[model samples]
Target: MKIAILGTGAVGTTIASRLVEIGHQVMIGSRSKTNEKAIEFVQKFDRNISNGTFEEAANFGDIIFNCIKGEFAVGALKSIEKIIDNKILIDVSIPVNTKNGMPFTLIPELCNTNSLGEEIQKNLPNTKVVKTLNTMWSTLMMTPSMLKDGDHTNFICGNDTEAKETVKILLKEIGWKEESIMDLGDITGSRGMESVLHLWWKIWGSTIGTFSIKVVN
Candidate 1:
């Protein structure tokens, strides 16, 4: 798969590195991609990843992963809306503004955690949007274990079955097995799933240490 990574932060770098390691063509998109780590990535892994602007990455990818922050995620796509027709978009974003945020799902989901995924789904009506990878820290995105493998839980919800399946395949390639991941039905569930991140922040941001929730049989 031709994967476009739309941010060069930790999440984007981690995903791109893993995908490239698995022999996928990855284009990393960033505001200024020629900087230190980006240059090092190009030099270190010549065949796997190529750096480009957002427009270049969007056009080059068969599947687009929007790993940018929630603030920039939608705008990044809109800037290149013409290029993202009918493509599978994997959104790893959360909608939280520092000052006015509450829990992921308060009374009526009233937290600053409004529906970021739904917003993206709305933005690119033609594009299939699947929300995953936002619930956990980047440490466990593809890898159930560690940097790129092991056991972890990441909730994925989307309106399109086929698009969801495609993400599942890629998830498998990234070492996620059937029981390790869950599908919470449709894209709107991201509103609730994001609460996991808030819970995580409170724990980690405090001193609760590394914590994970799993479904027990």
Candidate 2:
């Protein structure tokens, strides 16, 4: 599968590397084709991995992962709206804003009324947007077994069932347990999924380590 990662940040790089490791054709895209991190990734990895501008990467892939930071996610995605139509978009971004330099804070307008997942889906109506991996860090996202043998829960939500199924397969490929994945229903569920970041931030600060939720019966 050809995969497009729309960001050259930690999350995007981590995912692109993993997909490449799994033998997928991966491209890490940024605002410019000459992005240092993107170029470094291409130079370091196998030929299956490459770098390009956002639109180039989007057009190159069968699937798209929006790994751009929450603040700029909407604008960045909106820029390549036409190329992404009719493709599955796995949105792992949260809609957030930093306040007083404190990160992980939610944007005032986004709280309660909207979420980055829904906003992206709304703007790109033809794209099959599945919201997942936003609730956890990038490392845990593609390597869940690193923690408690991958027993923790991972949530996914979207309006399209087929898109969700494809994302679920990708999650399983990355080692997420089948039973550990929770289908939170439609895109509106992104509100709660994204809101979890607030508590996630608090938990990270107190523990100073990576941890995740494991739903119990």
Candidate 3:
């Protein structure tokens, strides 16, 4: 499968590298063709990987991963809207505000009542947007098995069933178990997933350790 990763940040790089390692053609996209991170990523991987402008990457992939920061996600994706029609877009970004100090904070305008996922879905109505992995660290996003016995939960929400299934397969490829992935219904459910970041940030700071949620029945 060909995958396009927007952002070139830690999350984007991590996802892109893992996809390439697993034999997928991966493209790292950024606002500019000369983005340092994107260029560095292509150089580092050197095989089965490429870098390009946002529109170029969007046009290149069968599946697109929205790994950019939440604050800038919509705008960045909007720039490539023409090329991403009908594509499955996996959004793993949360609108976080770091200016408040300490454990960082979420921008109320973009979260809580309204989430970045919902906004992105609204903007790109033609694209199938699935929200997942925003609740965990980038490291765990690709290697969920790092947790003891790989017994943990990850959530997914999207408007299209087929698109969600495609994302599920991709998640499994990156080490998520079928049963461990919880489908929280359609796009509106993303409000809950995005809000979890508040608790996640708190727990991450207190424990000083890496962990993921496990839904026990």
In terms of lDDT, model 3 sits at: 0.89
lDDT of 3 by residue, 1-217 (tens): 9999988899999998899988999888899999987887699866899999988999999999998888888888988887998999999988887667766677777777888889999999999999998889998989988887668999999999999999999999989999999999999888999888789878887786789888899
Clashes of each: 5, 0, 0
Can you give the TM-score per candidate against the true fold?
0.86, 0.96, 0.96
Pairs clashing within candidate 1: 144-150, 144-151, 145-149, 145-150, 145-151
Q: 48, model 1: CA deviation in Å?
A: 1.4
Over 1-217, each residue of candidate 1 has an lDDT whose tens digit, in order, gives 8999988888888888889988899998887756566667667786868998888888899999988877677788877887887999999877555455664423333234557788788888888999987777675775667632445577899999999999999988988877778899998787877666667777776765455666555
Instruction: Give the deviation of candidate 3 from the true structure as CA RMSD.
Output: 1.2
TM-score of 2: 0.96
lDDT, candidate 2, 1-217, per-residue tens: 9999998888998898889888899988899988887887789964798889999999999999999988898899889999999999999987778663676578766667888888888889999999998888899998998999999999999999999999999888878889999999999889999999889988888886789987899
Clashing pairs in 2: none
TM-score of 3: 0.96
